[model samples]
Target: MSGHSKWKNIMHKKEKSDAQRAKIFTKIGREIAVAVKEGGPDPASNSKLADLIAKAKSNNVPNENIERVIKKAAGGQEKSDYEGIIYEGYGPSGVAVIVETLTDNRNRTAGDLRHYFDKFGGNLGQNGCVSWMFQEKGVIVIEKAADVDEDKLMEDALEAGAVDVNSDDEVFEIFTEPNDLHNVRVALEAKKYNIISAEDERIPSNYVHLDNEDDIKHMNLLLEALEDDDDVQHVWHNWENEGEEN
Candidate 1:
């Protein structure tokens, strides 16, 4: 199971600032609260909550903070009016973009996204406009350490029912069917693999490359603006931006 590695691109684009980390925590906290409200606090019985806990840990969230959020949510102390919404659009040079958000105000989120797209030389489109270019899959990333054996890890991942394994210098990326994510992750954990992150992601089938410097700048600005929004949860796109020095 071999394919192009997207983890490198993801790692390069993620900002490591404290504010960015806090924003990540806030976003994950909202997701956890919603999961707890819908499926209960116990991750043992709540697979969604369990998955989210894994995600939070991978993001370096403190255990105490995760526990506090769960407890608050389970006790009904966390009241959120957030609703999940997806916005599809294009970045400069027709790069397909999809944004997932949890917002209390749809109008505000939509207007903000539209303005960002317009300002960055793109346009927000209707639902499904760019979604068709992507496929949903379970993506699990394991940090590559000195002790990690690439061949062994690949074998184990395949045995765990992963569909593909992609590797770079820093990490191993395992792809699995969406429904099998938790099971595959548990299997890997049982084998003593140190997971970096495990989550469902929309992967683009094809990538768009921009040769124009203006288009590249606009694309980067659009992505940054969307990611900075408090309401935005995840942003998926098909820009082949590896080695661009973000």
Candidate 2:
């Protein structure tokens, strides 16, 4: 937990260009569509949908866009049938990698991912090849500010059913059971904590360090390629890239 500062990754994402941010919104919209189709348009009754709505808001997705996507999805206006897929592999220096994607065409997604990995000095592997090295958890991140009380926040999070809290100069990271994410987030919001992000994430059991400059370069390229893919939603890796700029 100490090595995995999720805030670093969050800040990196926040610094992306406008076009990349739009791509992020589109990917999240697809997720919202799927959630609506599975449960319903009403976030009140659908916990998954509720969580996704919170996630969308944290990413600065506008309320109108969220409502429009929900309405369209509920009306069956979205015709694309997307399925969730998880791909596990290893990057340079045996760094474990897991990619979560939602794609209408599995063949195209697989081919693109494999090609990227190969070109970047990595290899896509069979399912569970690297997934076993990670654990799924609900992570809630809050931006640390001058007015925020660290002790009070920790107490509030624990009272709200959070398992643990980790902090750095920039943020407070609260960990919870995967199913308890929504409830904990709601509790924190009720307490008036400004949540930066709340979503389920796969935390690596251990991290891999790249000593060679080539390994580091290739690892970064591989991660960027996976993240830039239209079908890829979340990319998790075991690289201990705490100080390095991504």
Candidate 3:
């Protein structure tokens, strides 16, 4: 119910809508910049940067842009290198929310996020707000590995401490609790499985389905604004797309 799956599900639909497409690239790029600056610009040596790069590639961001960002960080020209922050809150219907942001100015980022939540039928909470309702995890999505055997992949993932696995039409997704992500990723790599993207995400323990269509329309407005922020990298909520069987 939480973590990567929820985000992925939303993004999958949004990608085709052309909504937030530009903002998506901006946020992902900022993530790439921060990861490189903090970890020394060597993806091989910096797992964080490597993961961000993988995500950028999936979204079709140009390699030149990524390379330029890495070089800028390496050269120290960028001011106030960004860092990721998790803001906990709640949405309508008591739905838990977690917003992950990468910002160069914590004060500005905090204020922007808080203002949005307050304006959109939700209120930002203290640090522990709603976070207790989630579990941190790593989600890996492999696009259409048709030749690969599911059981074998699951077995390898389990040996690496993977918690669960699921597949839909053209994607194979693997989940590993936060602590096991690195180990599980390494295991998968050793097997030469093609991985499309991987990242740290929050997953909710329970979901609050908006029974009213109007609630979804409004909830989406809030989610959209949160995502449009340049500093916001990911938004997780206990929302189920109507009629989506999870």
Candidate 4:
């Protein structure tokens, strides 16, 4: 919910950079396959499948491709034995970091993740080493307009059971507990409001502010290295931006 604009801005910048859209598609396809295998392909009866479909569409995944994936899952042609793993650690500048990954090869993924952390001046740690610094939350994004009534939006979201809300210059963001995400989203949809994006995220409880240029470079390298991992779905960290909400 906090710094909603910053989060949306970061995502917009990311979605436009498609050096390997295939990788993104593969990731989404994998998730879709997993969801279908676990709960069946009927989105109406499977909330996870429905969410994956929406995400795939937002990412411009083709309808034919989505259908093929659904068929593959329905026919049991795809293997989705992957397990979700979360690795926590501390990055440069004592920044708390959490990485969420889905992998079929746990050994390979774990080894690679540990190696990257060690090489990047970041150390992988025990379960609660850094996880205590983050809280899992549901985030819903809405694109901003030049003129919008913030109070009205806040009132609506609060009534819909959003736990907290934040607004940046270009977006209104709503946060909810993980279990409440779907309900709030359903409430919003009933009102004819379309969310630009919605996802489960780990927001850091606090932040570590960088001081020197060298520190910035070091941290960026660590983040980039972690992001390059194929198994990685999302990376969360506790780095502060002094620039504040825009």
Candidate 5:
């Protein structure tokens, strides 16, 4: 089973619930603000900002909201200086978990994250604890449009520096080296492909399957709590999907 994609599906299902859209907006807005602060408000001059803009649009973030965040960051309205922090931990059934956060106050965010881990069936760990189990990779998602030729698309991606490509019912997942993401994405765009999402992500080396009901419940809670935090940007984990078979 593909753990990351299955978990993404679960997250998408939950996004249908009330208030989830607001949460998504907030998360994407924070990303946009950070990108602008790091580079600039102009996507043309800032590759990172451009990628974030594409991501926000793929997630259905309103154009006005993205513009507002970029303008605010550029105008110094976002006064709080945030730093990126990664927290490693183990969820139920010893599933490796990594939480990425952008925080202005490290102490508070750490404390809250520790509390969530403790409240669930997990314990926070030191840096590099479980990160070794994952490798950084670029993931590009393209929707499976009508009349699209899968083999031809795969050939194009490979020729454009993509390392791997996988297709399912809904989308084609392309993998590339972290540094080659933008280049490969631009190449695909030149071919007039509809890019659904493109970003750097951690790919787990292995997955731990949770069959026990209690473990599944606790793991779900742990994921939910971590994702709910305002400082938390991304949560990577190695849990085998329940419905998807290897």
Candidate 6:
């Protein structure tokens, strides 16, 4: 998770931008709608919905908007049938790229993603082509503070069923099994830890370093292009930032 943290920091900065925030809200709204349809509007009765609510709140999504979307979805007013789609491919320098999208039209999303990969000098591959390099894990990031007790936090996370607790000067990355994410997060919340983000993520087993100037440039373009698509919810890749951690 060396370069990944920096990459996340970069994306977080982008999320602060006006355009990206609007896109984030739209994407998160679709997630809420789907969660409501799958489970129920009641977060207490629906664990998935509850986790999504927490995720939305972490992203600074307004409470009113979340309630409105849940109501609309529960009322059967949101007729757009969106489905989750995953596309696996390689970006510049053979960096494994996994693009997750929630879209009503599969063809449109596929075409748009294919175009972005092609335009950026990357070729989209068949499903599982690049995903084999990744693993599904529950990742929780907590911003490190001066007064925080690192050892106690690690012990707490481990006791909560976390597989690993990686701490640096910047943040504490707690890893857990995919199914244990919400439970571990809940435990940490109970302990009053400042969680920056908690969600399921694809952790790459090995990283691909992009050192060439052209490779880095094209890789950035590919990522930006993929992220700009409204259908694309999350973009996971193994591009290692060749620099020290923040």
lDDT of each: 0.87, 0.87, 0.75, 0.78, 0.84, 0.84
* TM-score winner, 3 or 5: 5
Q: Which should have the higher lDDT, number 1 or number 6?
A: 1
Better of 1 and 2 by TM-score: 2
TM-score of each: 0.93, 0.95, 0.85, 0.89, 0.92, 0.93
Number of residue pairs clashing in candidate 1, backbone atoms closer than 3 angstroms, sequence gap of 3 or more or interchain: 0
Give stretches of model 4 more than 4 Å off: 4-9, 12-17, 146-148, 242-246
lDDT of 6 by residue, 1-246 (tens): 553464464455455444667778888899999999999999888888888888888878899989999999999999999999999998877989999999999999999999989988799999989888988988888878886799999899999999988876678889999999989999999998898888888988888877777777888778778877899888888777732222
How many clashing residue pairs appear in each of the predictions shown?
0, 0, 4, 0, 1, 0
Q: Which residue pairs show collisions in model 6?
A: none
CA RMSD for every model?
2.0, 1.7, 3.2, 3.1, 2.8, 2.7
TM-score of 6: 0.93
Model 4: per-residue Cα lDDT at residue 156: 80
Best by TM-score: 2
Residue-by-residue lDDT tens digits, candidate 4, 1-246: 347534843664365446668877888888888889889999889887877787788777899989899999889888658788999988766888898988999999889988887887778888889988888888877767544567877888889889888887667788988877777777876766657777777887777877767667766777777767789887888777522222
- Candidate 3 vs. true structure, TM-score: 0.85
For model 1, the stretches where C-alpha displacement exceeds 4 angstroms are 1-5, 17-19, 242-246
Question: For candidate 5, which ten residues in a row score worst on lDDT?
Answer: 9-18
Candidate 2 at 126: error in angstroms? Answer: 1.2
For residues 1-246, what per-residue lDDT tens digits would candidate 5 score against the true structure? 253464365446445423687887887788888889888899988988888888888878889999999999999999888899999999977999999999999999999999998888899999999999999988888878996799999999999999998877778888999989988998998999999789888888888988878888888788878878899988888877633321
